[model samples]
Target: MKLKSFLSNLPARVILLIYSVIVLYPLLWTVTTSFKTTNEFYENPWSMPKSFQWTNYINAFKEASIGSYFVNSVLVTLLSMAICMILSFMAAYVISRYDFKAFRWMKKMYLVALFFPVAFKIVPLFQLLGDMHLLDSLFGLVLAYSATTIPFTIFLMAGFLESISKEYEEAAMIDGCSRFGVLFRIIAPMARSGMITVAIFNFMSYWNEYIMALSFITTESKRTLTLGIAYLMEVQRYATDWGALFAGLVIVMIPTLVLYALLQRKITAGINVGGLKG
Candidate 1:
């Protein structure tokens, strides 16, 4: 019986193995190619490098000025995420705990907003930012990112908040905790995993976002890592510095991979808890 069961699953396992290779091959190729010299790449694109070219990363940072762009991205993403999380937490707490008509309507509105694409808001956002003198500015970009992401963030947060028992808040209140204190010290900590899950999702979205960055920012100094990579690709088209281009890509991918690897367990637990309770 055991042998028969194993034989039945063999085809499915083989198919999954093939699918994994197909998915991972491009990523593997890009990493290997980043370490290859121009001549080595041209000679045989499929072959690994004889020696790792650390200079490719150096050129990407110094020549392409990816360092500055990286700083700008970090600033923008962190600021936006901070703002989005704080606001989303407060709003979700209210929407989840309060049974008022206005809060219910607001919840529905946010849910409806999630269905609309970001591209739909481009014209109005551009006009609004231009009027506010925020166009081409990093702060403005942060605000735009925050606003666009809030609806979904709130949605996720509300689910987690709903899962949390009101008894915790009530007990804290009995112990002389103010509403804000209960929220910050008790509720926030209790929902820690959910918060991290939402944050990681937002980080990836804010980090890799290109269309909004391209549309809003015109100044080279305010460019994000995504913009820097796009510009690097354009430069590579003429200069053919494929090594540096791939190196830039690797730089952009590192943070996300590291963050995911570290918090993957939290992501699974948070999603499961939120899904089941909410």
Candidate 2:
């Protein structure tokens, strides 16, 4: 029995190891490539640098306006995510706790919104933003991204909230706690895992968002990381700097990697707990 159990687990372990390598190799290559000189990168694209060119990162920042883009990206991501979480939490709480005639319709409406493709709405959204005098602005981009993300975030949060027992809220109410008080004191703490997961998801989405930011933010300094990376591609048209480009790529990837590493456990736990309860 022991031998059979060991054999059964061996294939899964081997597969996991292979998968991990596959996922990590591109990141490793990007980091190593960032440290290679341009000549070295061209000569040995597949191998590590003979001598690391640490100045590539400096060049990327100076030449590509990576510092400006990095700050813009951080601001956009943080603001959008903050709005998404706050709005989604409130919407989810209402949908989960309240009994109303419009509840079913509201859920269906959110589901429809979640599944709808943003491409279809681009023209109308642009027109609307133009009318509102919000075109080519970061605030407009924030509102757009928040609107796009809210449906799904609300859905996830609502599902998680629905899984919680109503008794907690009832007990809080019996003790004369207001609705807001119950939410902040009892429900929000319990829903911390789900909130973290939603925050991470929203952050990732906003960080890598390209099309909306590109369309809404025309000013050079206002461009986010994705647009900045794209500008690097354009700059390479006349003078290609593979090392600097890779360095910029590495910089762009760091925040995402760090965030995932920090929140992965909470994300998994949230999904698991929400699933079991729901």
Candidate 3:
């Protein structure tokens, strides 16, 4: 009987196995290739390394200047993520809970804003940033990323806030909690999973972002990791180093992988529950 039940679920298990292999194979290939020497790679790209070249990672960091780009990316991603989430959260809460003039229209406008392709905004955005003298600066990139992400973030967080009960807000206010305190204490905590989802999604997006970085950042010193990776591609045009290239990719993938691993449970929780009832 047990074997029969297991067999009943066999199709689902088989599908999952296929999906997992599809998702993980490229990452596995990249990591293993990073350890192969140039000769080993040219000899047999599919085979395992005869001798692991840990120096690939060192060369990526030192010679390729991934070290500086790593710091730049970390700073830009964190700051932009923080600003975007905070602004999105506040806007979402207000739209969900309050009734004021143009409130419905405002939400509709944000819905429309979500459809505006970011690439379309580039010309005007770059011009505006140039006028403000923010081009090529980290702060400029932060502003650009935060603005680009806010509309969708608001759309997500508003639904999460709307799903929460109003009684909690009333109860907190009656206990002498200020509006800000209620948000920080009650609402924010209840919405933790949604916030984490947004943060992780946007962090990864900004961390791996290339287009905006390419358009806005011209100075080599201000380049992001994504931009630095592009530089490696440019170097390859002159002299290809597949090992270091793969090593650089592994370096780029590591932080995102570690962050998601740490917060994997939070993602499932967000999908499972919108908000607490009480």
Candidate 4:
């Protein structure tokens, strides 16, 4: 029976292995290439570096102005994620806990927003930002990111919130806890996994987002990591600073990698918990 099951699953295991390699190979190549000198890369392209060229990272930071972009990205992503998560949490709490007719359409609206492409709304967003004198500013980009993500963020957290037992809130209220207290002191702890999951996903989205950053930020000083990478690519086309280019790519990828590594278990648990309860 064991042998039969193993044989039946062999093709699936093989396919999964192939897919994993396909996804990981380029990431491995990029990491290897980031540590190689231009001459070494040109000579072999696929071979491992003779020696790790740490200068590639230094040059990427100093010469490519990626350090500034990195800071900008960090600020924008952190602030945007904070705002998105806070608002989404509160909104999701209400939507899930309340049995009101008024709130019924709100979830549907957010679902609609999920499908609504930001591209179609860019013109209005641009005009509104410009009117508010926020165009080409990091704050503007932060606001744009926060507002746009709220709908989906709300949707995601609402699922987890819905999965939570209202008895927790009821008991807290009986113990003299205010509604706000019940939310923060009681419900928030129970929904910790969901919050982490939301934070991780939003962090990745805010970090890697390029199109909105590109559209809103015209000033070189305010550009995010994504813009910095794009600018690095343009410079590399003529300069051929392959080492710096790859280093920039690696730098861009590091945060998301760290975040996922740390919170991957919570992400899985959050989803499973929500799914089972729902």
Q: How much lDDT does each candidate structure score?
A: 0.93, 0.88, 0.90, 0.91
List where candidate 4 sits over 4 angstroms from the true fold.
Answer: 275-278
Pairs that collide in candidate 3 are: none
What tens digits encode model 1's per-residue C-alpha lDDT throughout 225-265? Answer: 99999999898878978899999999998999999999999
- Candidate 4 clash total? 0
TM-score of each: 0.96, 0.95, 0.94, 0.97
Stretches of candidate 2 above 4 Å error?
275-278
List, in order, the clash count of every candidate structure.
0, 0, 0, 0
- C-alpha lDDT (0 to 100) for residue 255 of candidate 1: 95
lDDT of predicted model 1: 0.93
**Residue range 220-244, candidate 3, lDDT tens digits:** 9999999999899789778868889
Give the alpha carbon lDDT tens digit for every residue of 188-251 in model 2.
Answer: 9999998998888888888888888878888998899999999897888788588899999999
Candidates ranked by TM-score: 4, 1, 2, 3
Instruction: List pairs with backbone clashes in candidate 1.
Output: none
**lDDT value for candidate 4?**
0.91
For candidate 4, give the lDDT of residue 262.
85
Q: Of the candidates numbered 2 and 4, which has the greater lDDT value?
A: 4
User: Which one is best on TM-score?
Assistant: 4
